[model samples]
Target: MKDGRHLVWILDDEWNSHELEKSMYNQHGFEVKVTRSDKLEDDMPLYAPCADGVVAQVGFQCRADVIDKLQSCKVISVSGAGYNHVDIEAATQKGIMVSNVPDYCAEEVSNHTLALILTVTRRLASYNRKVREGKWDPLDTMPIHRLSENTVGLLGFGRIARMVAAKLKPFGVRILVHDDFVTEETFNVHGVEPVSLNDLLQQSNILSLHVPLTTETNNLINYERLKMMPRGAFVINTCRGGVINEADLETAIKEGHISGAGLDVLEIEPPSPDHPLLKMDEVFITPHSSYLSEESIDELRTRTTQAVIDGVHGKHLPYALNQVKTETKI
Candidate 1:
């Protein structure tokens, strides 16, 4: 380490709680430097060459070009569960371990998913807008069904999806899950039914996505899959945006094939005002804020900093997403 301390660089655009992360890293004899993601390239030549580790958020893209520029970085720590923004293959090839704070926002995201389901199913947005605009007709939101009468399908039964299932169990809703990695026992223990992807898409009245973004999962919910869903089915995605084809979703909603959608993330963030989905009253969108809670943010920051500390100290990272040869010793 230079000057008896490890230097870690943080690339983020929205976070302002660096004091919390800085204090924790300082305790371990690490010096932290924070920079905005937009200015990372210019700042990299000045800071990255000497960085012992790097921390980044979803807004930052650490591709092969950026990865190739780091001269001494040993680990790339992501502040959230999804690390598709980081180039794992390039990091591994460069002997740089990549880690992520996966379990930090499980509760927050699952709660957000439930909120979206309730809003879309009850037509809460439509009712609220109509009531404010002097249209007080209960029939405006007709055909509202009880939660128990509908089936909810989960695309992937991971930590967050399991929490969603647990929260929804008391409502007596039939939950069907399709996850290749999970066994029938996993679903049985949660009081959920295990089903194939085709069955899940064909039978569910509400389909929620909770899978990571990968080659297999990218555009998993496409035109054909949307066609498989029963008419009037609602789609909710709190996971990565690329999992669902945005154009296909817009087409389905426009054609009245799919009833509505609740999306926390979109294929293109902060979509243009002219976007058709934004104009639809049947669609509800959040600005990728499903993983935010006071407690969760603190946990995410601490766990991410801890990963960098572990890497600098030559210790095993608890949430390492990639295996790399330990050649850079602090």
Candidate 2:
């Protein structure tokens, strides 16, 4: 590294756009070393030369064991929405602030949820399947339901959920939301009725998951909860994959307990092609990418990377995780 240069080592290979990062950091005259490897030990070969501090994507493990390898490391940056993979408690104890990019794609996620909902509602997947099978008139088997009379239940009333509801207003669908963080007044603002999970399950014609994954949220929709949803209602999960039990979802869909489902994320990414759910006709699965547009990816990269850069320079984090003070500063 050049003398008087601050080094920021990168552990994410795909984002190793060396030129983009190099040009961006050169303004500040920092040495940017990128070591791209799935295994932390493999980075040992380049550790002394490349890694002064680490900025990682999903591939890099920031666990205590791997983090111990850094020599002059001062900060760790995680580039994605979730920070569960990183041991934030350990980092904080060591006086390193952990940060994440938040709400960069709230619009994109809400738009994607609606696309999934509309695909199932309009029977687009079924139509596409029929054409591939040389069957022209697929609509002969089933009719699309009218959205005007349907009840759309949102599992959480976060910013994205609110956008979904707003866009759904043109359809004249009834909106019900269940988020413990939401206020009754907030629901009244959007004409959304607040309800219990059971009530939401029983009444919704289409349901969407929007909450973050946490201890309280893991497997939130298990067998019993799946059984609770109205038999004909469609379930849409764009939230974290583990939020819904995979086995139970397959069972529920196979038994005709629920009408259909649209899943953007799954328990294990790139689920086996032969997974029972894939064989079924009622489920629409995308390979865990509802936030893949260039715009969103750029925002996530810049914001997440900048958060760590700011922390290293002794500035407050751009979007910190759970570090809100009474003054409400980020």
Give all candidates' CA lDDT scores.
0.89, 0.76
Per-residue CA lDDT of candidate 2, range 1-330, in tens? 325567787767556475755666767667776766655467565563334446767535667765655545556777876666677766655555567765878888888899999998887888898888999995564757888989999999988899999999998999989999999899999889999988998889899999888889999988888888877778899878889888898888778787788998887767887887888778888876777789998777777667656765767775666442222111
lDDT (tens digit, per residue) of candidate 1 on 54-114: 9978778888888887778898999899898899999899889999998999999999999
Candidate 2: residue 51 Cα off by (Å) = 5.4
Best by TM-score: 1
Of candidate 2, the 10-residue stretch with the lowest lDDT total is 321-330
Model 2 residue runs over 4 Å out of place are 1-4, 13-18, 44-53, 70-72, 322-330
Which residue pairs overlap in candidate 1's backbone? none
- Candidate 2's TM-score: 0.89
In order of appearance, the predictions have TM-scores of 0.96, 0.89
**Candidate 1 C-alpha error for residue 38, in Å:** 3.2
